[model samples]
Target chain A: MSSSANEAAARASAVSEMGRTIPTDAEVPHPEGVRWGMVVDLDRCTGCQACVVACQAENNIALNEEQRVLERRAKTWIRIERYWEGEFPNAKARFIPVLCQHCGNAPCETVCPVWATYHNNEGLNVQVYNRCIGTRFCANGCPYSVRYFNFWNPEWPEPMNNQLNPDVTVRTKGIIEKCTFCVQRINRVQVTAKTEGREIRSGEVQPACAQSCPTSALVFCDINDPESAPAQLAEAEAGRSYTLLEHFGTDPGIIYLKKVDPHAEIHEDEHAHAGAHA
Target chain B: MQEPVVADTKTSNRELLDFVFAWPAWFFAVGGALNGLLVAAFVVVILMLMFGLQFLGYSHPVYWGFLIVNFVFWIGVSHAGIMVSAILRLTQAEWRRPVTRAAEVLTIFSLLTAVQFPLIHSGRPWRTMYWTFPYDWNRGAWPNPRSPLVWDPSAIFTYLTSTILFVYVALLPDLALARDRAPNPVSRAIYGVLAMGFRGTTRQWRIQTVAGLLLSAIILPIFVSVHSIVSWDFAVTSVPGWHNTIFAPYFVIGAVHSGVSAVVTVMIVMRYAFGLKRFITRDHIDSLARLLIVVATVWLFFFLLDFFFGLYGTEPAEVDTWQRRLVEPPWVVIAITFIICAYIIPVPMWMFRAIRRNFFWMFVTTILVNVGMWLERYMVVVPALERKSGLTFTYGDYAPSLSEFILVAASFALVILGFLTFSKLLPIMPAADIKEGQILADRIRVGRANVPAAMRE
Candidate 1:
C-alpha cells in the first residue's frame, strides 16, 4: 500500500481503538473534544414540516400511515409542534421544532437495563437498537418525550422499500429509537476528514433535518467548537437562546432562539377578553 | 395473646393430609379452568412474539400499561409469604402455624408469576436474558447496575430463593410425614428424597427450628428491600407522579396491605375448598383482619403523604398529574374506587369484632382490598405517564388492549394453578407445625371466662 493510504489505515484503527477504550460513563468527553449540537432559530421557523419529512427519508423511519397517526402511535423523529396565541379572530400560530435534545445529562441514558441507550463522548444520546430489551423505562424517564419505541416492525411497500437508507439500520420491533442527529452522516464526514489527514470543517456535518430546512432555522454544529457558526450564533443570540425544559437540568445540546413576538401584550389582552366574554 | 383452641394431633394430621393424598373434584374443576386460561395466555404470548408489541394497547408517550400494573400487583401479593410466615414465626405468634405454609406457597407462585410480566411486556421477550442474567454475554457489557430494572430481578430472585428455602426448611418434617404416608412406591421415593432423611429426632428438630429462625432474620431485610427496589423503578424516573421520595415506604406498606389481604382471601378459600375449617378457624381470620386494619390504615397514611407531597411541590407538571388523577373522568373514578376499597370501607368494617370474625365478610373485604390495591398500582403507573411532562402536545392516554387483559388474567391463572398443583404435592397447611402448636396449647382462667393461652417453652 501507498504511504498515505497506510497512514489513513493506521489513523482509522487508532480512532476505533480509542472509541473502544472510552468509558461508558457519559460524563467523559470525546478524545477529540467534539460535542455535536444544534441551534434552532424559532424566528425563521415556518412550521411547514419539511425537516420532519427529510428526517424520515434519511433515517429509514417507518412510513406513518393515517391509522398510525389516528391511533397516536406514529414515529416522527423531528416534529414541528404548533401552538396558538390569542383567540380565533386575533389568533397567531407559533411553531417550535422538537427532537432528541441529546442532553449532556440525558435522563433516558440512565434507565436502560441493557445500556441500550447511552451518551457517547460526542455528546450524542445513542440508542443501540439490537441491545434494547424494550422495557420502555427510558421513554418514561425522558421529560421531552422524544424517545419512540417500535410497536411493530416497520413496513415500506413497493418502490418505497427500495428507498431505504443503506446507512441506517431498519430497527426491529420492541426496541426504542429516536433522532441520532443523523450520526451516519456525521460518521461519513469524520471518516472523510480522517482519510485525508485533516480535521472536519465547520458546516460540513449537517443532519438531514438541518440540511433540508428551507429557512435555515435548524443549524447543526459541534457546540464545543468555538469556530462553528451555529455555536457562535447561539453565543451571539444569548438574549433569545434557551433550551427546552431548562429547569430539568438536562443541559441539552439543542439551543433554541425564542420567537420575537412584538404583539405579546396585545395577544395577552385579547386572550383575557376572549376568556371573559366566553 | 388469644390462641385458637387446638385439635388433636392425629385429627389435624389426617385432615391436613387429606387434600395432599386425595384429589378433590373441585380441585380438578378449578385447576382445569386456570390451566385453560394459562394456555390462552401462552398462546397470546406466542402471538406477541411472532407479531409485535402492537398486540398491546401501548401508544406513544404511554409505553407501559396493564402488564406493568399486573406485575406490581403480583409482586405486592408475593409479600404475603414473608409478612405472615417470617414475621409471625419470628414474633412466635401461634395463630401463624396453619397460615404459614399456604402464605409461603402463594409467595413462590405469585413471584414466579410476577417476574414474567416484564419479560412478556418487553419488545423482545426472548432477548431479555441479556438484561436479566448477571453474566456479561455481550462482549464486555454487563447489565447496567445503574438501572433499577437490574435491581428488580436481583431483589426479586433473592426474595424468591430465600422464600423457597424458608418454606423448604420448615417443610422437612412435613415432607418426612408425607414420605411415611406415601400411597405408592414412586410417591414414597419422591417424598423420601425431598424429606432429606428427617427422623424427627430432638437434634433434628432443634436444627430445623434454628434454621427457620436464621432464615427469617436473613429474609427480613430482603422482604423490605424487594418492594423498595421495585418502587425505585418508578422513583428513579423523572415522571411526575412516580418520582416521589415517599415511594419506597409507600410501595412497601401498600404491598404488605395487599399481600396480607391476599393471605386472608386464600385462607378463606382454603377453609372451604380443602375442608380446612378446623385448622383455619374464625379466630385466625379475626387476627388477620385486625392486622389488616393496621396495615390498611398505615397504607392510607403513606398514600396521603404521597398525595400531599405531590401537591406540596407546587410544580406545574406535578400539579397537572395530580389534577389528572383527581379531576379527570376515568382516573377520578379509579382514584375513588382505590380509596374506598383499599381503606375507607374495609378498615372501618375491620374495626367491628363481628365483621372481623365473620368469614364471609372478611372474604369479601379482603378481595376488595386486593382489587383496590390493583387499581392503586394502576393509578400510580398509568396517570403519571399520561401527564408525564408540561409538554401537553405530547401527552396521550393509554388503554390496555384485549391481549393485555388476556395476559393479566393468565397471570392470575398461572399463580392459582401453581398453588393448586403444590397443594396436591404437599400439605397446604403445615402438619408438623400444627402438631407442635397443639402441644403448646393451654388455657388460663380470667374473670368468668377461660381465656385461650399457650405454654411457654
Candidate 2:
C-alpha cells in the first residue's frame, strides 16, 4: 500500500479500537448472580412507618412537617400505603411500603424533556439531579405519587444540617426528587467491587430500609439472578407478590408481597384496608 | 418600541388605549395581595400543623386534604390561560388579540405556580429527583416514558413553548412599532433587541402571519392535550371520580370557561384603567361576553353529562361523589350555588344587552364566573377522595396552609408583578395590528378587493 493509505488504515484501526474499548467510568458492575430489587412481605408488614423513617434517615429526605403534610407537601421517599379490604367489622388494613418501584418499564423516564431520568444497567431507575429542570412532569405522570418536588430552598437548623448525605444533592425549589433505592450506596458497592477486581456478592449493597428491617419484611436482591434471595422469595411467593398500580402498564421495579389476609376468608363487613380493588 | 403598522381609525385613540390596560395591574396587585394574604395565612397554619404534628401526630390518613385540594385548584386554574389563547387564535377570533396575551401569560405563569405544589407538597422538597432514571454521570439510567409524571414535562414543555412562541410572534410587529415610536434611546434599544430586527414590510408581515397561524394551529391541540393529560394524572388512576372517561373534554371546556371569564375580568379592568374606550370598545366587551356565555353553557353541559353518567351507573363511590357534591349532609346547596354561579348565572346575565352594556354587571359576572370555576374544580377533586372507600373524613377538611397560601398569593402577585414590568417595557396594544386593522376597515369601505398599500407598510 502507498504510505498515506497505510497511515489512514492505522488511524482507522486506532479509532475503531477506541470505540470498542469498555467504558470504565459509566458502568454498574453487576454482582455475581445478582439483580437489585425490593420485595416487601405484606404478611409481615404492620404498616409501621419504620421503613419510611429508616429510608429517610439513610437518604436524608427532608422532614415533612404538618403543614407540609397538610399541603401534601410532605415528602416520604418511601411510604407505607394502606389499602382497605372488606367492610367495617371485617375490614383489614393491607399495609405496603410504596416507593419508586424502580420499574423495569418506568413511566417517568420517557417524558423527560432533558432526559434527566433513565434506567441503569442493574434495572435501577435513576435520576440525574443536575440535568432535571424542575418542571415536575414526571411527578404528575407517575401512577403512584412517589415523585416529589422541592418547592422552596430547603432549610435545616444549625448543626442538624450537617447530617445531609454528601452523596445526594439537597434539591432547591422548583425541581422534582424521589427515591433512588439508595443508588449512592449501590454506586459505592460497585466501586468497592471494581477496585478489588471482583463482582458484587449476594446480600451486599442492601438499601438502608431492607438492611434495617427488624422483621426482615423488606428484602432486596437481584430478581434476575435466580439464586438471589429476593428472586427466590419472589418465586416462592408467586401468588402473594405484586406491584403497585400494575394496571397502568408501568412495570415497576419494586415488588410487593400482598398484605396477607389471614382473615381474608373470615373478614367481611369490617374490612378497613381495602386493596385498591376499586 | 412598537411600530405603527395600521393607522388608528377611531376618532379617539390614546385615551382609550392607555386606560383599558392600566387597572388590571392595580386591581391584580391589590386583589392579588389580599388573596395572597389569605393564602399566606393558610400556608403558615399548614406548616405549623405539619411541624407541630411531630409531638402528637394523628395517624388516620397520612396524605390528606389541603395538599390534594391545592393540587386540584392550581391545576384547574392553570387550564384556562393556554386553552383560551390557543383555541381562540386557532379559531380565528380577532377579539382574542387584545385579551390573548394576558390569557396566555396567565397560562405560563399559572403553570409555574401550580406545578410547585407537588414538590412543596412533599414535606421535604429536597431530593425530589429520585424519580428520574439516571443522573449526569450517564450511568444509562433515565425516567420511564410511560408514566404521567414523565409525560407531564413533555406536555407542559410543549404547551409552554407554543404559548411563548405565540406570545413572541404576535408581539414582534408591536415590538418594532415600539422601537420606532420610542421617545428615548433606552426604550428604542430595548424594543430593537426584543423586536429581533422586525420591519413591517410585506414579506415580514406575510412571514410572521404565516408563522403565527402555524403556531396557533399547532398550539390548539397542544393546549387541549395538556389539560387532558393533566386530567389523566388523576384519570389514569383507578380512583372512582378521577378515572371517568369524560375527564378530557370536561377539563378542556372547564378551562375555557374559567379562562374566558378571566379574560373578561382583565379586559374590564383594562377598560377602566387604561381609558381604552375605543380600542377595547363596547363591541369588544360584547364580543367577549358572548363568548364567555357559550363557554359557561358548555361547562354546565359537560358537568351535567358527567353527573348523569355517574348517576346512571350508580357506582357507589361515584354516587357518593355526586351526593357529596349535590345531596350530602353538608351544604350541598352551596355546591350547587357555586356551579350556578360559574355556569348558570353567567349566561343569562351576559345574554341581556343591558348586562353586556353595563360595566358593573360585566365585572360582576366575570368575577362570579372565575369563582364558580374554582368551586367546580374543588367539587370535582376534593370530594372524590375526601370520602374514599365509603367512609367520609368529614373532620379532615382542607384549608390552604399558610405557606402554600402565601406561595399561591405570590404566584398571582408575581404574574401581576411580571405584567407590570412587561407593560413598562412593551406596547400594551398591538399598535401595528390595530393600525393595519384600521387600514383594512378603510379598504373595505373603499370597495378595494385588496388591503390598502399604506397599511402593508
Candidate 3:
C-alpha cells in the first residue's frame, strides 16, 4: 500500500483505540490500559552482558572505554549491576540489568525546568534533546541513576561510524540521555502494523535488551494486553514479581521476579547487598 | 557637633575623583593583573563549552560541583549589602550613612558575578537564553514553574533591577555634587547626565528620600527571597542533604551572616583606600561588629538546627549524608572549617569591643567568616551529591579541575575590578547623606545625653 494509505489506516486504528473520539492532532491519543512494560526474570539471567552490547549497537550509544568507566562517565542506556552474595567457598554473583524505569509518577519528569522530558500518552517517558539545557536536575531526581549526561562530544572512528544506526540520532555533548525502551522500534512496528491494517500483536516490538537476552530472562510486552507474554509471566510470577524502589512510589514500568536462591540466609547480615531485601 | 562629612569639600572631591580621572601606576598594575586573569578564565570557560564539562571535572552523580559552589558563595556574599543598607535605613540608624553606598555597591557587583554561574553550569550555555527568556516561538514551551531553577531567573532578575535602581536613586545627590565640582566640562557633563537634572531642590530631596526608603522596603523582600530561591534550587531536588524545610530561612539568615561580614571587610578596605577614617570611624566598625555577632549567633543556631534535623530524620539517606559530611574523610575537615571560620572563631572574636573597633581584627574575622561561608556552600552542594540513592555501585567523587580554580580566582578579581572601576567613576561614600545624618545627630541635645533627634521633612 502507498504511504498515505498507510497513514489513513493508522489514523483509523488510532481513533478506534481511543474509542472513536475524533483524532485532534497528528499524533494519536493513546488508548487506556496501553502501558508498555517489561518483566525481567532474575532466576534465568546468567549475568551475561549481551543485552548491554545489543543496546549500545542498536542505539548508537558511545563506546564505554576503560577510562570513561573509571571516571564514571560511561554511557550505558541499559547496564548490568553485579552484586556479590557471600565470601570464600559460598560466593555467588547476581546480575540485575538496570534501565530507565519510566515511572508513572516520575520524579525526573517534574523537575525538568525546560519541559525537555515528559510522559507521553502511551506511558513512554519522552526526552526532547534540543530543548535540554543539561541542568541535570532530572538526573538528580531519578532514584535509579539510569539517566546519563553527555559530558563530551560523541565521536566515532571511520570504520566504526559505518555501524551507526540511521534511525537513532547520536546525541551531542552537554545534554542528558537515557533508555527510551527502543521507541524507534516501537514506532517502526506501529507504522508497519498500521500499513497492514492491524493492531500491534503481543511480543511484536522488542527492545534491544529483550531481543538479545540469551536465556530469555528479559521480556518486553504491552502489559495492558492481558494475553501478552509479559502480562502472562507477570501474572504467573505475581508472588515473586516486584518493582525496583517501590517505596519511592515511582510505579516503575519494569518488574523483576525475585532471584530464588536457596542460600539467601547466608547473606542476611550484609544488608548492603542489592537484592530483594534492599 | 554637626560636622560636614567631607572635612574639606575641595580636597575630598579631588581625592575621590582622582581615582577615576587619573590612573596611578599601581592602579593599572592591579587592574591589569585582574583583567589578565579574567581573560584566561573566560577562555577556559569558552573551551569547556566547546569541548565538554569533562574538561571541568564534572561527571555522573556529581554533576554539580565547583560552579554551583561558587554560585551560592557569591550569592551569599551579595546578601550583606541589602541587609546593611535596607535594614539599617528602615531602622533610621545614623551610622549607616558612610557604609550604605559601599554595601549597596558590593551587592550590585557580587550579583553581577554570581549571575554568571548558572550560565557556566549549563551544559549548553549558548542555549540558556532560550530556556530563560519568555518569548513564544515554534516550541510552544515555557520553563517548568515547579522547578526552583526556573524560580531562580525571576528572583535574580528582580533583585538585580531593584538593586541597580536602589544604588542609582541613592546616588542622585552625590552625582549632582560630583557634577558641580567636576574637574572639567567633560567630567561635569557626564556627571550631569547621571545626576538627571537633580538641582538638590527641596522637591528632589523629598522625592529622593521617599524613593530611597520605598526602594529599600521593596528590595528587602527581594533580598530575602533571592537567596531563599537560590537555596530552593537545592532544596527542591530529592538529594538527601538538600530537600529540607529549613532551607529557606536557613539560607536567608546565612546570606545575611556573610553579607554583613562582607560589609565590614569592605568598610575597612575603603577606610584605608581613600583615607576615609573620619567618616568610616571606629564607632561604625564597632556597631557593624555587634551586628555581626548577632548574625553569627543566629547562624550558629541554624547550623545546629540543620544538623539536628538531619540527625533526627529517620531517612537512611539523610543519616548517610550527614555522616559523609560530619564523619567521612576529607569532608570532616571541611565541616570543621565551616564551623570554625563561619562561627567558632568569628563569634568570640567579634564579641570583643577592641576587636570590633580595630580595623585589622575586624577585617581578619570578616574574611574568615566569608571563607567559612564559602566552605559551607561547598559542604551543602558536594557532600549531598557525592552520595546519592546508593543503588549505583560506584560512589561519585569530585575535585575541581585547574580550570575551575582559575575561574573561581577570576570571579573574585572581576568583583574587585568592578569595585575599583566604580570607585573612580562615583563617590564610594555618600557625603550629603553623612552631613545630613550629622545634622540630625546634633539636633535636640538635651543635657549631656545628646538624644538622636528626628529630622523635619
Candidate 4:
C-alpha cells in the first residue's frame, strides 16, 4: 500500500479514537514540500525596536511596568536582543531580534514533564498552556532565554483588557510561555485555506516581526519551496547565513544573516610581487 | 508530662517549662517585629524618595542595591536550616532528634522570607507572579525561561516542596506522639490532623524512614543546587563582582554557617526556654558551634581564593569590581567587620571550650555570625552594582522602596506565624527519633560495659 493509504488507515484509527466526528472523508493533503524557515539580516536591523512593539501588539504581551523592569522581572515573548561588540574607540554595538528558533531538535519539547509543548509537523514549536502544570523544566532546559513564565496573574486594567486576543487563552497565574510562531494566526490561516480547498500559500501568513520589518531584514517563509525569498536570500550569500549556537545541534528554524563587514582589509599575495620582491 | 495535673498543684510543671523555653519564640518574635519595623521605616523613606520628597533613592548606577542585598541575605539564612536537617539525617546524628524539627521549620520560613525579598524587591508585590505564568496564554507573550530569574524560582519551588515534605514526613510520628500526649481533646484533635493518622508500627517507621532518607538524598543535591542556582543568578550575569567561581561553594558554606548558627541559636533558646537541659545537651552545642566556625573558615577561604584568582585574571571588569568591593565606604567597612566577626574571629574563640560551652557567648556568636553572613550577601549583591562596569558603563542604584520594606516585614511575619502555628500543632522534635536515640545510647552503654576484665585477660 502507498504511504497515503497508510495515512488513511491512521486517520481511520484517529477517527475511532475521536468517536467519529461527522462523516469521515479524512483524505487531507500531506502539506507537501513545506519546511518553514526564517532569515534574519542583522546588517539591515537598525535596533529601532519597531519589531519589538509589533510582535508584542500582535501577540498581546503584557506590559511590565517600571517596578517589574526594576526588579529585573519584566516578561517579553520577543524582544530586540541588544549586545555590545568591540571596545571603547572602535566599539560598535549590535542588536539582534531574538526569538524562538523553532528548532527541529528543540530542547524545550523533550523536558516538558507534562508534554505541555511539542513540535508539530510544520516546524513550529507549540505550547499548550492549559495542559501545563507550570513546572518550568523547559525554561531551564533552553539555552536561549526565549521562554518566559507567567510569574503572576496578568492584569490589563480597564481598556487594556479589551485589547486581548479572543483567539488565545488568557493564561492563569502559574504556567510557562514562549513564542508560539503565532500559532493562533497559523490555525486561522490553516482553517481558511482548508475552507477554500487549497494548500497554504508560501507568503500567506508571515509572523508579525517579519511583516513589521521596514528594511525587510526579517523574512519568514517555507524553505522547502526553493522559490521562497528567504531560501533564495540564504542561497545568494555565504557572508549571511548562520544560526545562533549552532554547535549545540538545535537546527533552528530561525536563521540569522551574519552582520556584513564592509571594511574588511584585502591583503596582496606575495607571488604577484615575487618578480621583484622575491 | 501531663498539664491537667497542674490544676491540682500550685502550677503545672509542663506549662511553666513551656513558658520559660518559649523565650526564644518571644525574642525571635520581638526581634523579627523590630527588624520588620526597620524594614517598613526604610520603605516609607524610599516611598518618599520615589515621590521626590527625599534627595535620593535607587539611581542609574545601581538599579538593585539594598533590596537585592536583603534578598540574598535571607536566602543565605534559609540554606543552613535545610542543610542541618538533611545532613543530620544523612549522617544519622542521633543528637539531631531534638533539633531537626526546628531547623526544618526554619528552612521553610527562611525560604518564605527569602522568596519575598525578590517579590518586594520589585516594590510591586501584587504583580510578582508575572514572572511565573502571566495571563496571556498566547506565544510571544510569556515569561523568559532562559533567564536566571526563571531558573531561580523553579529551583526555589523545588526546594520548598522537598523541604516541606521533609518536615511534614518527619513530623508524622511526633504528631502522633503529641496527639496521644496532648493535655486536652482540642490539642489532640489538632495534632491528629497534623499527624495524618500515623501509628508507629515497625512497617510505618521503616517506610517513613526510607522515604525520608530518599527525600534527603534528593533534597541535599537540590539544596546545594538551589543556592548554587541562586548564586548563579549573580554569577551568570555579566556584572564583575557578582560573577565568580567561588560563589557556588562559598554561598553553600555561608549558608551552612548561617543555618548552623541559627540552629544553635534556636537550641540555646529552647534549652533555657523549655528547660530542655536533658534533651539538648552541651555536646550538641559544642559540636555544632565548632562545626560552624570551621564552615565559616571554609567560606572565608573560598572568598579569598576567588578574590585572588579574580585579581590574577587581571580582567578589567574583575579588577574594577573588586576595587569597588574593597574600597567602598560605610558598606565596605561594615562588610569587612562582618566577615571578620562572622568567620575569622569566631574560629579562635570557638576553639575555646568556655566560649563554645557558655550559652551567652554561643548566642552572641551565632547572632554575630548570621549578621556577618547577611553582610557577606550584601557585599556580594550591592557592591558590584555600586560602581560602573569594566567598560566604565553604569548600571543602576537601588534603594528599596517603602512597599518593598513592608512586604519584607510581612514575609518575616509570615514565617513567624507559620512556625508558631506549626509548633502549636506538633512537637518540634521527633519523639520516635528521640526514643531510637535513647535505645542506641543504651545499647552503646551496654556494649561498652560488656568489655569485661575477663575478656582483657
| Most lDDT-accurate candidate | 1
**Tens digits of lDDT, candidate 3, B90-129:** 9888788889999989998999999898798888888877
Instruction: Give the DockQ-based CAPRI class for model 3.
Output: acceptable
Q: lDDT by residue for model 4 over B1-457, one digit each (tens)?
A: 1001102111222432253224455657655676666566566645533432222244333445555666676677777666777887788775666778778888888887777656544423344454554333332234455456667788888898998998888878767766766767986788788888888888988889899999888898888888888887767554567657778887887788888898888888767755567667677788788778678878878888878987998766567667766875656696688878787777788989989888888888898887787667767776676553422322334566555556555555666656655564456555566655544443223554742222211
Cα deviation at B330, candidate 2, in Å, is 9.0
Q: What is the lDDT of candidate 3?
A: 0.83
Model 2 C-alpha lDDT per residue in residues B204-260, reported as the tens digit of each score:
989998998788777777877887887776666544566688988898788777766
Please give, as one word, the docking class of candidate 2: incorrect
| Error at B168, model 4, angstroms | 9.3
**Per-prediction fnat:** 0.79, 0.07, 0.66, 0.00
TM-score of each: 0.94, 0.64, 0.92, 0.60
- Give candidate 2's iRMS in Å, 1 decimal: 9.1
Query: lDDT by residue for model 1 over B295-347, one digit each (tens)?
Result: 88889999899999999998889999999988899899999998999988899
* Candidate 1 local Cα displacement, residue B149, angstroms: 0.5
Candidate 2 chain A: minimum summed lDDT over ten consecutive residues — where? A20-29
Runs of candidate 3 with Cα error greater than 4 angstroms are A1-31, A265-278, B1-22, B443-457
| Top TM-score prediction, candidate number | 1
**Of models 3 and 4, which has the larger DockQ?**
3
Best by DockQ: 1
Clashes of 3: 1
Worst 10 residues of 3 chain B by lDDT: B1-10
The Cα error of candidate 3 at residue A111, in Å, is 1.9
* Model 2 regions more than 4 Å off: A1-119, A123-265, A268-278, B1-10, B13-248, B304-338, B377-399, B416-457
